[model samples]
Target chain A: MSDPILEVKNLKKYFRVTNGVLKAVDNVNLSIQRGETFGLVGESGCGKSTLGRTIMRLYNTTEGQVLFNGENVHQLKGSRLKQFNRDMQMVFQDPYASLNPRMTVGDIIAEGIDIHRLSSGVKRRERVSELLQTVGLPEEHASRFPHEFSGGQRQRIGIARALAINPQFIVADEPVSALDVSVQAQVINLFKRLQEENGLTYLFISHDLAMVKHIADRVGVMYLGSLTEVAQSHELYRNPLHPYTVALLSAIPIPDPEVERKRERIILEGDVPSPINPPPGCRFFARCPKAMPQCQVDTPRWIEVETDHYVACHLYK
Target chain B: MENILEVKDLKVSFHTYAGEVQAVRGVSFDLKKGEVLAIVGESGCGKSVTSQTIMRLIPSPPSIIKEGSILFDKKIDLVQLTLKEMESIRGSEIGMIFQDPMTSLNPTMTIGKQITEGLVRHQGLSKEKAQKEAIELLSLVGIPRPETRIKQYPHEFSGGMRQRVMIAISLACRPKLLIADEPTTALDVTIQAQIIDLLKDLQEKIGSSIIIITHNLGVVADIAQRVVVMYAGKIVEQGTVDDIFYRAQHPYTWGLLHSILRLDDDEKSELVPIEGMPPDLLAPPQGCAFAARCPHAMNICLNEDPQTQIIQDEHSMACWLMDKRMRTEIR
Candidate 1:
């Protein structure tokens, strides 16, 4: 509707392995409106995390531009880069490995604040406590080490750390995958509440489709370093255009026993092809049930099949 | 159908440095022959502990089976079996698979050797015969190029394939019971579906009773005929798959069901998360363990643990809300 808070144009990130260059994120494009949650979903090694990190400038882009608020994120340096860092943050997947075990929870949360020189001494302490409270942790929890807290509590601390710098955009990469089901619900709710309160834009990346559907205004499905489908959460789930998207949706086991038993699942055959020197055609051609002879040779063009829904598949064309 | 496995009043505890942690408190359930039973719970809820205890996998020095009997084939109390005798039954009579395939599988050995080792030791098959059997097992689990893949090490296989190899190894001896502890948790949703389907297909062919231990209700619904809902080291609810999903009684079970972001549901509906964490295993609460987090926890629920109330022929739950007296009081 309004100007996109974050925009990606022909983004690519490649790692030169011994064999070949691993195209982790290839020719990707996306735009996230202010206060919108853009969910990125795919299996492991599907470049969801890579795309998130590339957008956050955690990795140097192999190609293309990340425009944050009309400013090229790749070109920003020194004070401007520092300002970008303050405005954007990331909540990592693993709470156990992400947080330093040696650091106190308060110190960990305030690391961003300290780096940005936002507060000092008593004020810093108060800010840390307030952030801890914001993420549903008590003030006393700030004194405890990461090991003292449970997995769920540790995740809350991670969220608090991300929110410390008051970032307008946060890239949460598989933030709740490690958490238990009930605890995951709590964290998701917290994310929703924080987004509402702060008017934040989130690049919420996860392999869990159901979770992404719950939190994301729009959802994007990645398959082996390329986005296969992107659409409104409800629209995508209801009528998945890409064969990969349809299979992925069908594969997710519903908790309802009756539906689960009755449903005809499209269980995709074969593992995701290696990203290093990936196949020339559609990445999902190997396993796609509806793949044709042309699909094996011709790379499908990304097209807007519906009013807002987009898909990259020969079938859509 | 006769129950293949029956766990009665099973109580297990770990002797920690801090204190004795009661992991499983008077848990009991029965698994019919050729049926799939799923034990669903969050971490520290003792679902894994119960399954491990059934397989006699927990280390005994720190972990102790305090009271109860795990009767296999209605005669053998697995708890009473000596280590020597249990070893005989471990793989041949009951096979177990863990979550992480990389760790469970040996790095040095070929996939063929790993699968055949059990066949040779337990079934007394010749090296050639065992190797042939291993290839067949691999093919059975849907691993392509079973002959060539069998020679390769675990590292050569993909995550999904490695898991298939794990399944192949587990089913080599053709045990009467197969215990899969979060078999697909580490896998992607598509791979997870494939694995579940493979397990179901293999179950039909082998006809071994399955006990799938997982925290995911979705996975439970996909593969299991019966479901057991555990909370804070206790079996809070047990019923048929339909009963557990549609007619759940325990507040904990309801909370668990409600908390999950279901694909079929409207995306806008706010998830009702169970407030507060699972009780500390070291010093669990005196009353119902889930009472603290349960939305409908009553005074009695906070004060005393409720006894298992049989709802129907095969459905049961342990909750004050399920009690006839509580229902009458509410009316």
Candidate 2:
């Protein structure tokens, strides 16, 4: 499309471990438009969260570039980066630890506003109250501490805080995984509402493919730090070319019993290989049902199997 | 198909200084032999307590099975059984697997030792026999490199590996009925699929019924032959999986089904979340607890709790909307 709001090119992050090096995020590329939710789905320790933090520069990437508004975000220094902070905000998965427990809800949301100097005194309070109401919570909840609220309420508070900076983009890292299912639905719809109201760009990271399918316009499937598939939500679900995507989709329990019984199952055999020593070729080869000799010899290059649908599986190649 | 286990008019309450919290209120359901029964509900629905009570696993004083008869194997009433009898039943005739493999496992023990411990102690098998059985269990659960992984600590295994290990340990004695409470909620989608498939395979190999308790509608969708919908400590709906899925009549079931974000649905691109929180169990409404949030709530819904009305075969619901009196009111 036209210049993306955010572009990540061959982003990589490695950790020096006793075993050798942990390749948390391998050569990966993706883009998020100005007002779109780009969902990144993978299991725990698959480096989805690491990727989000890396995009926000919370974790320094060992290699690759994160472009914000066509500018390399990694290169921004001092005052220049401070301005970047004003435009982007983040909400963490664990609400219990994400927000300062000691701080009142009002103070937590206001902390970002004060840092950005977005408003002052009564005006800031009014803005904070407005944000709270927007997320389907009362302004009176602003005075309560994080513990005072239920898991769902606490997440709403976190959402309120993210909106405090009036950010154009938000990195929501597994934002609903820890909450109850019904409450998770609440937080998810809140995100949708917030997106519509603010015209915000989102890098939604989660292991819940079901949740991702609900909010995301486009989804990128990751395995061992590498992207296996990226496609529009409708197209991907309807026609998942990648073996991993097929397995993941089949695995999701469709609330209907008849469909569930009849739904073809793809049971991957082996666990995901460690990122530090991801196999010589495709990360999914060990578990892929359609893996061939070519898959074991070399990693499949990301190719467009259909219009706007991308997959890095030898089956497509 | 006879009832493998029957829970009749179960009432569980935890006595606390704050007051006795009515955790489970006259909840009852039956699990048929060789049939997978899923207890589905959101948090604080008393599914866990009900399952735990069947195992006589609930600690007393603060927690008590205030009233109910848990008929296991058509003869043994678990609620009346003593600690000694419960111990024999556990891991031998009935087994349980909890969520969060990290906490469920013994950190001090190796995977092999932990798995074999239940076999050796409960079944009275020799250590040598138990060790061999443990290895077999590990392999059966599809834990590759099982021989080596058995010696590894819980920390050494990945989350998926650890969960498989938990399954291996739980199935050591091959209990007739296996209770897996939110077993795969903490696992990734791919790994979760593997685990679910493994459970299904194991169940087929050995003719054992499975009871999967989870809030995830997606998880219960596949393996559960029948499903029970719980809310605020009572079963709001119970029926065959087909009945629950396609023709769920209860408002709560409709809300639950609609609320869940399914990966399989294009319509769920924007998941319609149910507004308002579940009622506090300590103060469950005199009428239907879900009446507060029910879109089609009638005036009688707030005045009286509807009886469990049967609709067609094996499907039942508790809601004023389904009550014959409400039908007349609507007319």
For model 2, the DockQ equals 0.69
Note the residue pairs that clash in candidate 2. A253-B218
Where is model 2 more than 4 Å wrong at Cα? B267-270
What lDDT tens digits, residue by residue, belong to model 2 across residues B180-296? 999998887777888888889989998788889998777787788899999989999999888998889998888887777666565755566778998877777888888898899
- For candidate 2 chain A, the 10 contiguous residues with the lowest summed lDDT are A270-279
TM-score of chain B of 2: 0.96
lDDT of 1 at A15: 98
Clash pairs (backbone) in predicted model 1: none
Residue B94 alpha-carbon offset, candidate 1, angstroms: 0.4
Candidate 1's displacement at residue B224, Å, is: 0.9
TM-score of the candidate numbered 1? 0.98
Tens digits of per-residue lDDT, candidate 1, A1-317, equal 57699999999999999999999999898889999999999999999999998898889999999999999998999999999999999999999999999999999999999988999999999999899889988899889899998888999999999999999999999999999988999999999999999999999999999999999999999999999999999999999899898889999999888888799988889999899998798888899889899999998988898988999999876
